[model samples]
Target: KTSLVVSYTTNGYPTEYIPTAFDNFSAVVSVDGKPVRLQLCDTAGQDEFDKLRPLCYTNTDIFLLCFSVVSPSSFQNVSEKWVPEIRCHCPKAPIILVGTQSDLREDVKVLIELDKCKEKPVSEEAAKLCAEEVKAASYIECSALTQKNLKEVFDAAIVAGIQYSDTQQQPKKSKSRTPDKMKNLSKSWWKKYCCFV
Candidate 1:
């Protein structure tokens, strides 16, 4: 099972101050004593996504969609566009919603002013709503720097993948034979006949 972390951006430019965000995304999960492969990409909006959609469609089992809780716009972009596009390409893929920089709330506030020249407050309620709308299998508030809640994120993803894999392996049941068929196939035919006699 392959895992991909998807993030969207306007143009090919990385969302202004997300370099640290990338660095902190080092969450790890192991399957059957083997480490799972993880991929990170910036969809770069519709144009870039169009080019990458085919690749994702053919590959990828789980997607961890991350956005900053501080930036409502980023959350909106993923909710309105990225999530749907990824779902369309990989319908069966399990998705985990992650809110990054849980330890850097102070830094997030500073960056918001520096990058956008405006102050926007982070809202936990809004993040929860976004997570719900996207049908996120699990939601994690994490910090890549401190590694807080990072393990939980990967753990949840791995559990979800395993559960999904197990579900797919379950054998399908066929329709049961009718009463007449059961009677004919009974193992105690001689006993029934002797009893009757």
Candidate 2:
């Protein structure tokens, strides 16, 4: 996840790994001819941070639930853990299921490592099927190192986030919009938030 964020924001991979408990990054991009502030909250994914992670989910418009394509265990955790936790907290928010490390899926070294453990890289078909089972808004395979499909991943998130935000602001009543509703919409429309888990 760190590599993915760094690559997208900086167009290069991190030189070294640094453990993070919680961190946030922001980038402004023009989506549909309108400037959208993409606020990304990179939360800790370790088991020790499990109790504290959900606190960041509040008011999240969208989520990027990612796993390494070369790590089958991580892929399994997407359905067994991540999706359930996200659904419990933000049921209405859209999720873009991401399979990261795409560039390593066929690397000879990586394949040899997995073969020794009797495991194989998570296939794209399997990932898409899991997305369907989890009802994800969309599924994408990307390589931070190669910068492959990285832009499309965030593009999907922004589009989905905006759509979700619009739905939230829609008036509940069948009657015409009132002045109070318009005021609330104007005040909150500019605020868009997304989280990386």
Candidate 3:
């Protein structure tokens, strides 16, 4: 997850991997020549953090629901664990299913290990089906190591998020004219009377 965040934010491959249970990274991306501040929240998949993780879901515009393609169990968790958890907290938020570690999909070492366990890399077709099952807004396959389709993944995310936000944005309430009784009040008198703020 950090790899996804680091690669997108900095555009340089991140090394010396370190894991943080709950981390937030901020990045500004240009969408149509306007800067959109994006906050990427990375959460640990450990069982203990599950209880505390959903607190961040409130008012979230979009979610990147990621799974490792080479690890079938992780893919399973997308349905069994992640999607349900996100839906419970932020039901209406748009979700983009992300297939991570695409670089490892065909690596000999990774394939042999999966074969030992009688497992195979999750296929793109199956992943797309899973995305549809979860009603995801989009499905993206990307490799953080090689930076393949990495930018596109985030671009899709930001675009979906922006669209979601636009629909959810409450229409502005026009300001009413000040009451006649309050209109003539002196500035100093008003400040002294309403200084509670």
Candidate 4:
């Protein structure tokens, strides 16, 4: 997620692995002389953050449910972990199923490693099928390293967020919670990370 936002906003790929626990980035682009803002929320996918992550979903307009194409476990999590979680929190929000790291699908070293594990790269057809099962609005495969289909991912996010906002429920003020788990969460949290272009 950080890579996606950083690549688009900075036009540079991170040289090393630097995980983000949580961060929000904002970008404003002038479209036809009108300024449009986009927010990209980078949330940790670790199991420890599962409870805290829902706090970011209260008013989410759309979800980009992403999984690495070369990781079978990640792909499995799309249906087993992600789709269910998002449905519970944002039932009406649109979802765009994303297969990340398409560039690695053909890497010999990666393929050999996966072969040892008796696994293969996820096929586009299978990804699309999963999208249908989850009722996702769209499915796209992209490689941030190569910038392949990267712009389409964000473009789809903007379009779907805008369209969903028109028909979806107004952002309901989430009930104030006082638990320590909720202490660091900001109101309008989703807005801090994402906006329609």
* Tens digits of per-residue lDDT for model 4, 88-160: 8778888888898999999999999999999999999999999999999999998888889988987787778
Candidate 3: residue 49 Cα off by (Å)? 0.3
Where is model 3 poorest over a 10-residue stretch in terms of lDDT? Answer: 188-197
Model 2 global lDDT (CA atoms, 0 to 1): 0.91
lDDT of candidate 1? 0.53
What's the true lDDT of residue 86 in model 2? 96
User: What is the overall TM-score of model 4 with all chains considered together?
Assistant: 0.84
Where model 1 places Cα greater than 4 Å from the true spot, the runs are 1-49, 108-119, 169-197
Residue-level lDDT of model 3, residues 1-197, one tens digit each, is 77888887788778788865877778776778866778777877888877888776765778888889999999999989998888887788888899999999999999999999999999999999999999998899999889998998888878888777766653354254356534542221211000000
Return the lDDT, model 2, position 172: 81
lDDT of 4: 0.76
TM-score of 2: 0.93
Q: Which one is best on TM-score?
A: 2
Compared with the true structure, what per-residue lDDT tens digits does model 1 show for residues 158-186?
Answer: 66655654454344653566677557544
Name the candidate, 2 or 3, with the larger lDDT value. 2
Please give the distance, in angstroms, between residue 131's alpha carbon in candidate 1 and its true position after superposition.
Answer: 1.3
Off by over 4 Å in 4: 30-33, 169-197
TM-score for each candidate, following the candidate numbering: 0.61, 0.93, 0.86, 0.84
Model 1, TM vs. native: 0.61
Clashing pairs in 4: 39-193
> What's model 4's lDDT at 140?
90
Stretches of candidate 3 exceeding 4 Å from the true structure: 172-197
